[model samples]
Target: MTALLTLAVLATLLGGTLFAVALDRAYLPLLALFTRQRVETEAPDRLNRDLAPAWYLALAAIGIAVVPFAPDLALIDSPVGIVIWGSCEALIVLTVFLHGWSPNAPFPLIGAYRYAAIGLPVMLPSMFVLIAAALPAESLSLVAIVDSQREVWNVIRQPLGLPLFMVVALAMTLRGPMDYADAADIATGTSAEDSGAGRAVWQIARLAMLVSVSAIAATVFLGGPLGPVLPGPVWLWLKTGALMALTVWIGNRVARTTPSRMLTILWVVLLPLSFLHLLISGLIAL
Candidate 1:
């Protein structure tokens, strides 16, 4: 089990990175459809400022590395597994902010600000979902959360929770319609100044972050490794992949939202809805 868990973590990180790299290349042809003629490929001039791509990568690596182990397969399961996972996921946002700010470029700076502006609002709602998940388990251990769903998955019990969490996950990863951080309107936004291997690392980190978050979501709501007929690890991976695909599809079909509008919706709509979900979940638990 230890070996399997370790392998799952490594595979999620490395595999997600490679998948993201390939996805970027694959999207090139499609991206051209909406791009104006004569899209610029020039690397932005670096500000006379010290930059550390390694720092960005290191932080993201640390943040995502611990998430895959949050389920039953965890090598070091603790009562606070949910808190640990949440902290790590939050670090990904800081990593992005630093990645954008470190370059000291105009577009990237604005993009980083946009990322924070939209990213922060969604976090409370996401936490509400997490709280809802933990309430039934009566413990913060992610494994406990999964075990609580043995009789029935949390998605069915708290139907609003899964979708709400997914929406926040999309925003957290800056994917799909919530991709204003790297939106085309801002010359790829926070990544505009990146080039060569530096850019590659950044892209990989983003993808890995997405994979890690999806894995957590699976564990929290989908009853990780609790499916019938399949091995635990297989079930976990299958669910993670499905969630990742759903997130990607949503991003592809939905129009990109501006940071301000996203903030408005998050505060006025998603926030209240998440609270209502929590209320419903608590009532059901009783």
Candidate 2:
């Protein structure tokens, strides 16, 4: 199990790197047209500046590494697996904040603040969805959650839970419409100062974060590793990929919202809806 988990993590990291590279290459022609050509530039003077993005990348990798494994195969399979998942989600935010603040640039700093403002409100709905998933399982262990859904997947049982969770997952990964953190309007916002290998690492980390959240959402609501005719890991990856693709499609198709409007919708609409979903789940459990 340990070896398999290690292999999975390494594979995900490599895939994430490739995904980032592909995205960059896809946009290279447009980038070359608009991007300013640089001559000679001095290396960063501060050692901390040189190392900070790496630190951010390391945290992102650590957070993502634990996500693909089933609870039985997990390194830490506590009853509070949901809580741990939340902690891992938080690390993605920290990574963005660190990446933005490390360079001490104005736009990046503002972008980091925007990340916090948007990211924090989504947590409420996310926790409610987690609670909805836990209600049927009667255990916080993700393994137990999957087991509880042996008869009926939570998506059918608590339909609202999956959508709410997916929204929060999208927010956590800064994908889709929730991409205020590094939006193009702010000169790539939090990542404005990033270049070369550091930029590559940051991009890889973002993709890995998306993959990680998709895996968790699959586990919680889509019946992770449980499908017809396919192996557990294969089902898991397929679901994760589908969810990731959905997120990307939505991000590309939908217009980005202002921070204030996002907050209003989350608090006024989504928050109450999540609570209602939790209420329904509890009644159904009884």
My TM-score estimates for the predictions, one after another, are: 0.85, 0.86
The per-model lDDT (C-alpha) reads: 0.73, 0.73
lDDT of 1: 0.73
- Put down candidate 2 lDDT per residue, 163-254, tens digits, no spaces: 88878867776776788788777888887876665565566666666677777888888888788887777777777777777766766677
Candidate 1 colliding pairs: 176-251
**Model 1 agreement with the true structure over 143-197: per-residue lDDT tens digits:** 7888898899999999999889888878767788888689889999888876655
Candidate 1 residue runs with Cα over 4 Å from true position: 1-4, 19-71
Flag regions of model 2 displaced more than 4 Å: 16-71
- Highest TM-score: which candidate? 2
Q: Which RMSD does model 1 reach against the true structure?
A: 4.9
